[model samples]
Target: MADDSIRGISRRKFIAASGTAGALALAGCTQQNTGGGGGGDDNGSGNGSGGGSLSGEVIITGSSTVFPVSNEFAELFMDEHPDVNVTVDSTGSGGGFENNFCPGDSDINGASRPITDEEVENCESNDVTPVEFQVASDALTVAVNNEADWVDSMTFDELSQIWRDDGAQMWSDVRDDWPDEELELFGPASTSGTYDWFNENVIGEDYQHTAEHEPTEEDNLIVQGIQDSQYAMGYFGYAYYSENEDSVKAVEIREEEGDDPVAPSLDAASEGTYPLARPLFIYASEAAAEREEVAAFLEFYIENSGNDTVAEIGYVPAGDDVIEENMETLEEISG
Candidate 1:
């Protein structure tokens, strides 16, 4: 696909003015460059480290939620092997696979949720089989305005009630003692993997109820919405919440009445007590795996971008067992 990295921002001018940090920031954003055949390594030292003699580009697009983790991995990978260029685009998970998998334009697709059966069928029909890798775990988080002191925690049923189409629109409607304030809702778009996971787990069969909440493809917009109003509450991947902890308050979640509520955190999510945890994935096409650069980058990603990288990006690691299984899967794919 076309590189839509920075629209009017010239890469060279941006690099010259902002240095390496700005280049890395530009890497993770949606930008474009039309003057060149393909982008090259203008940010790293021209020396190869322990990484193999792999040269060429590894293009990854998908999941704005997973973009930070993969972008960190790409930054580190290019540091070791400057000759190998890596680009990560933050398209939503479904758009990522659809745009890059059938025609096989990308080496890897970063996803926040599992690939659907229909997506798998489409790739297979196009002669591309995807090898899946579980990279990290994320706790879908709900947050309210920092001033919303009346709510400390909520049960799954209560959350469903708040989000239901014909359900409560006032805080006092949810709880008799609470003030009668109009409830404002913000959330991710239907195309977002985070949205899918929440819809399946929290909204249940009444998925159409989400129409009441304002939806946007951008997580930052949701964050901003929550920050703007005391009555506002919204949900997105845990990473965004963690990054904006000071501006918003995270709502504790309980599966049922008797269950103790659990706060969203690395420990709670990894231990399965968070009540809204889900696995994150990256699917590599078998055709792309044939390229040495693609293979090397996948190996590096599975091996190095776990605990430290996940934590740095405000996500929970998938544990040693999952990482080991991922390594095995990557080996099988490249073999």
Candidate 2:
């Protein structure tokens, strides 16, 4: 992301930048590095409070959605271990896994969706064994403009009609009272884990697309699209919804067996009652885990992520118990 985070511009400003940015990707978005911190003192200082370096170079690339959380973790971890270089990249979840697991490039691969059998096979082909760690829970949120007040929440069936290809593209086609205007959609590419989650839930078995909303695969773009137009609708992980709530409005989603429509939130998402709720994961290769640097960084992430790091990045913490389990596992690996 750009420094505009502090400037606070309208979605229009973002779109205008998009037009000129030529294939603006949701990759490693570097901010002004806030260097200068103490080093050498891991008396369990936790989030780099004591300021000691972790000891080597660590690279992470994956879901743009996961980047913020992992980046937040990295920033804090590096503060303590400034000597260790920790890098997080968002090349889309599937892309991250392919690059890391196939070639085994990344120490950790963050994903918005669960690992596929194919991805697992790819890892095995490279003689890499992957172990998954559940970092947090997420609700796949869909948002529309605040101006469109007729609908507050929707059934999965309704959402399906709204976005799936060959399905009704107009808002009214899904709901009788909705306007006849066609709904302009925005979302990630097919390579994204978010896309797979969306298709399985929103698009039915026969779903196929003739066209798609583009150039803005990052959730921020979806936020911009919806904020720009009342008729626009898009979906992404809930963290984006929380970060862009002022500009975008969240729609309630009805789970198949649910009694009431629920809006996405940390509480609702954690319980799995939110229709679009699911777990977020990071799959790491044994080879990567063997590296002292990779081991230290991933350990730091699991620790800090459940602590202050993830929340700062607009995400909920996976419970303390889960975090403890991860830490214990890390100690086992390093010990």
Candidate 3:
């Protein structure tokens, strides 16, 4: 069954970005899960189910940021292997790792952050080992209202000056040419994986001024906040920003000395020009991989979908060459 723990914005944003809108008929799935023991029809379809039947259910849960990518893949996979029933749950990256990655129980888990030593221990604690798969990268895009004209890109140093508590809080505070209202900040809650990434990569882990505003795990909340205010600044994974392209504007972060500050376009993000781009992932237990359903799902997922789904979801694709390489990795590992 699905969990209603997260607010609505994340779901809506995901639906918008991932082309889940195409399957609008399949929203709000609520089938209760009994620890992923169920399987599906042995003769699943598209991409050729490899002449096998998956008789059980495959439960995947993890980072909301990673959900769209995986979910899009999952949907396509299910289309390929009719017998393979798969379910994806978005309980935040941290929640999935903490609650669902029980070695003997859950099959796969996704995380927005890299696994910690403690979490590795946690995986082993329940006898479930973890394997990392770098799926795609994302950027923590800082966006503003579309009407904003005085600024274009920002530097980490400049970001720290504007966001960390000690930095002036208003758009005008950073520059005299900008408006003089107090700086308004919106961002993910402390528990979010993106939050940690933003802290370490963007603002430094020891940022001084983060306490002045709301820290929400919901990207949609941050999106709404930013959309509603002109003086506000916020960050979320690239896909969220992409989905709301009509409502928000992505700010560029200045990089090389000769290069123009670049916004988070698919081209810039894929080529690594976007400063905040990062690899996304999911960890599957060896036991999970051993299952025909799991194997077929992953095989079909990487095969039929891959980077196409990434682009469909509004984030940059991993590129056709990268997609082929990932397929090769899966074939080698699964074989």
Per-structure clash totals for the candidates? 7, 5, 23
Instruction: In model 3, state the lDDT of residue 168.
Output: 76
**lDDT, candidate 2, 1-335, per-residue tens:** 31314122322343354332121111221221111111222222243323463477777777867766676566656666778777766677888778755577777878888889998898888887777777877777888899988778888777777667777867889888989888888877776888877788667666753255653446677778888998888888776776667787888877553568788876666556677877788877767777777776666566554443344344555666777777677666655
Which candidate number has the best lDDT? 1
* Candidate 3 residue lDDT tens string, 1-335: 12454322243455654334221111121122210122223221134355435566778887777777666666656555556667777766666777787545567776677877877888888878776666667766898877677778887777877777677767776778888777778876655677667667777767754777767656777888888987778888877876676777888897544566878765666677778787777777766777777766665544433323455465544444655665666665566
Instruction: State the TM-score for model 3.
Output: 0.78
**Residue pairs of candidate 2 with colliding backbone atoms:** 40-52, 52-80, 52-81, 53-81, 54-81
List the candidates' TM-scores in order: 0.83, 0.81, 0.78
Better of 1 and 2 by lDDT: 1
* lDDT measured at residue 63 in model 3 versus the true structure, 0 to 100: 76
lDDT of each: 0.72, 0.66, 0.65
| lDDT comparing candidate 2 with the true structure | 0.66
List the lowest-lDDT window of 10 residues for candidate 2. 29-38
Candidate 1 residue-wise lDDT, 212-303, digit = tens: 78877667778899999999999988777766787889999999998999998766776777898888888898878878888877776765
